[model samples]
Target: MAGKHLLVLIVCLILLNLSATFASKQNTTTLNEATACIDGASITLTFGFYINSCPEAEPIIFSWIEKAVSDDPRMAASLLRLHFHDCFVNASSFQLGCDASVLLDDTPNFVGEKTAAPNANSLRGFEVIDAIKADLEYVCPQTVSCADILAIAARDSVVLSGGPGWEVEMGRRDSLSASKTAANNNIPGPNSDVATLLSKFQNVGLSLQELVALSGAHTMGKARCSSFSARINSSSSIISNSPDVNLEYLQSLQQLCSQSDANTTLADLDHITPTTFDNQYYVNLVSGEGLLGSDQALLTGNEETRRIIECYAGDVEAFYEDFKMAMLKMGRLQQVNGGDGEVRRNCRAVNQLGS
Candidate 1:
């Protein structure tokens, strides 16, 4: 009878332990599902997410960005593009939340997205992000997220570059991993045609109008000659013969993109106003002076895109309005927040146990 009682007691203890473990697993699963099931429109991001916890967060990030851009005006475009690339990769899949995955350094378990084909040698401004994160960490410790810093820096970049400014929704957290495959597959390349560009945008729930507005971002950046050399060299290129493209412009491009200089030379996307954030990108497209195949495709690809190009070309105010709205919408894609993610001590790697 004593032996039986002891056996019964052990059995009851084992069952209780099992029950607790199962409950813990179930809770973890539920939390993960909640984290993965983000709705861009209904996300919990706010205008002043760190107003109390880190009141000086935005000003710190903005000041850093302003000083960086003041030193190198092109840094404004680089930071803006960085934010877009980071968010676009996250928007590729629900599982890949908008965490600072793009900022991750390659680990044994995974390769970083920064070296992926679409991003390799193309994406810049990582150093600026690192610097901003370092400053925030010094002041706020782990209170601010790298993702939020990215969003804010992007906003400040545009403002300093003479573009419209919009309120950035914050409270994003960093992810544990980066996705090289997603970055390569989802990011539209310079050679992408209209259909490809449209599909890529639509995959992230962006509209055709939004696509046009976002492409306006190209107004301030420079493209490598490699991105457009084929257009100048290809037999099918209308650049050499098109009535819309100016002959002097084509000759100049040909000279700039000679075979020997393909990898080293760069061209402004908007030759007329390369440093400003305006509707001049659309104007360039309308005139067939677009620097990349992708840029020119906006005007020549579809009637709808062409109409948008025409509209933006004529009305800079309309482009600015739509660009701001599109940027806000894009920034919300697949965000990870709440208890599902963490604020990394460093932007380039996940926080270690002590560090």
Candidate 2:
């Protein structure tokens, strides 16, 4: 009983600190340096597999994450997104699971996913991963895989953002090639309807609940206006016809995006508690304030989605648990048919094209 009470006290203290740090913009120290993950017993290919081969691997990567996130709090979300974009790609020619193919650079012989419509100028944190891999190679050369680094970094990001964590499966290999074609087709756009979102998730072995839970990630980052301008623009059919938006909020969004660079303008996904990884995203959806049409679609998708949203909005712990589980499942995905797999000394290229 005392142990449980102690844990509760610790959590409360962490939340209090996070709120203070965020409430002050002058404090460039955005994301917290410490991790809040309370659990790590979920999945493991061989528990502590790196303990023997490269004891310094996880620590090295984690140290870099701490420094990077401390300097730029938004980095935590970018690392999490790096893993997400890495895992969702597919190729008609070859299989490319969570192999870190998304990190590859384009060559004369073939293309990569960076330039895909969903990814072009959208992804970040590549340099950070490069630094982590460089340090890993220095301590234990060629022992850690880029794919595994992404998974671990993602878990750490969530933990630092006041979310739950799970043991990431290690030993997953990296991809030898990336697929621009697959990335274009596989990743869903922000304007996707609930049906399209459901189809996309289902194609990757996820369900509707996972869909609702994973969308909760929106609780952190900001979405570019280009991604959802149609939903709030008066000239767009979605705004003119849809009944799922808050009029006052929509007006603010319109004014914000009215700039000539409106397409690149940014807006928070969750207006309430946008920095913390809480259940506020679900709460926003229930109130029709979800930034992206795809996100708001969950509320009106059907009874099941609506029920899941309401449940998460009412219970934060449940949202964390479900989000963690869904992320684990997403980390396991390899959408491409038969892509290459090997640990490259440099994450940007496969073994053959060593930098």
Candidate 3:
């Protein structure tokens, strides 16, 4: 018992030390002098080390962006996460599981005729960025782009969610076009079999193994019944009948998401690992209990993908390392940074400067 107690204490201390190290690494000293290269690239720059004369300006703005939706901490966190959630699997062309049509038609929609929205699998990061950008614009005018805000917000989100802190290279310019066609052609869908999914990831310069690991992000967020309805029911509208799906769970889900419109109850994929940012997502895959058909496909259908899943499921450290690399890769997708494009003052508004 004494030995066990000592072991637990040592592990806790190590974790605490790691946490402190992560915090120190993340809190960059505000820079006041000239442009310093942030991530080794000449274009990368930051303002962390310098003392702010208008210190209240940034804090008030940051705080406003964080709490513009409400005084709630969870809402603040959601603002930080909304950008990623919105763009993860863009379905602009298909509206697969999104309510984008509501915006297109006379019906009232949240973000206009935008191809993404209220999607179960949407990067929850979008909702937050909207609030943050609105607040920041009131303070700093045109100094910050939604893209830079997004990059910062995602890094902070990862740390707050208990993952390792990543170095954010800034100066990414905003995109003028939010192409529904680009999203449809690029974003991988829930029903995609492993090969199709791999091809999609490869298009973005990611490896097959990294593709399997990246799906672990689904472990944290909510999924609309529409997003997973095909897995649960025998409807040709969305998911096809696959041997890999769990029959019993599908029957239960049909009760919740039977509506043909695809808008209904949402399910949390990693119910056990809700906000912890851990490897239980991979572990769940091994149990033949992954929520989406696309999820289970990682462990089934393909031997190489399945083997990678097995490795990640068994080794937590390996999963963490792979996840970090995969995230870095995902963050790089379709970025219109620096010379690529101009920073949009408003994220929702396309770059009129380009036209």
Candidate 4:
């Protein structure tokens, strides 16, 4: 009788263990679903993915996507790829080593390609996503897609670099092709006047107002000495070239590039209020101190565009609302949805080699 009791007790213990394991698995599955849904929504809103349906899927997917980008440095690099393409579109000669055509003036290093330096303007924003990805990897291994990772990383990057914090809906599947050609064709240029900038954004369903607001992103980061050479060289009348930049703030930068040498560094067009996500970019336009050629063009170009720029510049809250809406629109561009692309195990590489 005692032997029979022992056998019954062993069976009961096994049953309890099985039940606990099943419960744990269910909890994990639920969490994954929620994370994915949010990530998908953020990407859809920001990049214009499968706009109609992905709203439900975003929250579920973000956990995995967020983890992949913030956990690994390599994953952050992969995410930075998208931003790199965006930045590349602003100029004709980003990677050409030395393209004199993009020179602002005769400045020595004030060349457009200066941002290409490994330490200068390269994907410094990826650090935020890298930290998140590391934590996610520890909790869930091999469960997230790198493409989603890229989307989230891009959103976080904007906020990290002293801009507005965007609502990043995740669960984006990885992209199979990283088209160098497509990237080159789509990006805008530093010399692009207001009209050109408007046409490009409108082609993708964005508006002129949005174009001006999104340009506010330029507020953060360093510009190569080359980017501002045009303003300085156009006339010695410019104060920056005459007195040398103030030492307390601008002194170190002047020393780094030299005063007499036209190789001077310019703040990101929106640097006056770089850390805050606000209407200062537009306000800068009103003040006649806008940075990039493309930026000033909004004010000086066509009448309709100038009116819109003025409106946004005058009203801070209006700019914030419009900027958010525009950001959501830009994030959804040309995304392939629903089984069109693989959920890449490694964002940098496609599917696992042997698998």
What tens-digit string does per-residue lDDT give for candidate 4 at 31-115? 2232111111233423223334332222323333345534542333334334434423332222210101111111232332224
Model 2 poorest 10 in a row by lDDT: 30-39
Identify the candidate with maximal lDDT. Answer: 1
Leading candidate by TM-score:
1
For lDDT, candidate 1 versus 2, the one ahead is 1
Off by over 4 Å in 4: 1-121, 127-131, 153-166, 235-266, 353-355
Q: On TM-score, who's better, 2 or 4?
A: 2
Give each model a TM-score: 0.85, 0.84, 0.67, 0.58
Candidate 2, residue 336: how far the Cα is off, in Å: 9.7
Cα RMSD, each candidate: 16.1, 9.4, 10.8, 14.3
Tell me model 3's lDDT, rounded to 2 decimals.
0.53
Question: What is the Cα-based lDDT of residue 235 in candidate 4?
Answer: 43
In order of lDDT, best first, we have 1, 2, 3, 4
User: What is candidate 4's TM-score against the reference?
Assistant: 0.58
Give lDDT per model, in order. 0.78, 0.76, 0.53, 0.46
User: Pairing residues by index, what is the TM-score of model 3?
Assistant: 0.67
Runs in model 1 lying further than 4 Å from the true structure: 1-40, 91-97, 240-244
> Which 10 residues in a row give candidate 3 its minimum summed lDDT?
97-106
Which ranges in model 2 have alpha carbons more than 4 Å from their true place?
A: 1-44, 92-94, 240-243, 335-340
Q: Write down the lDDT that model 4 would get.
A: 0.46
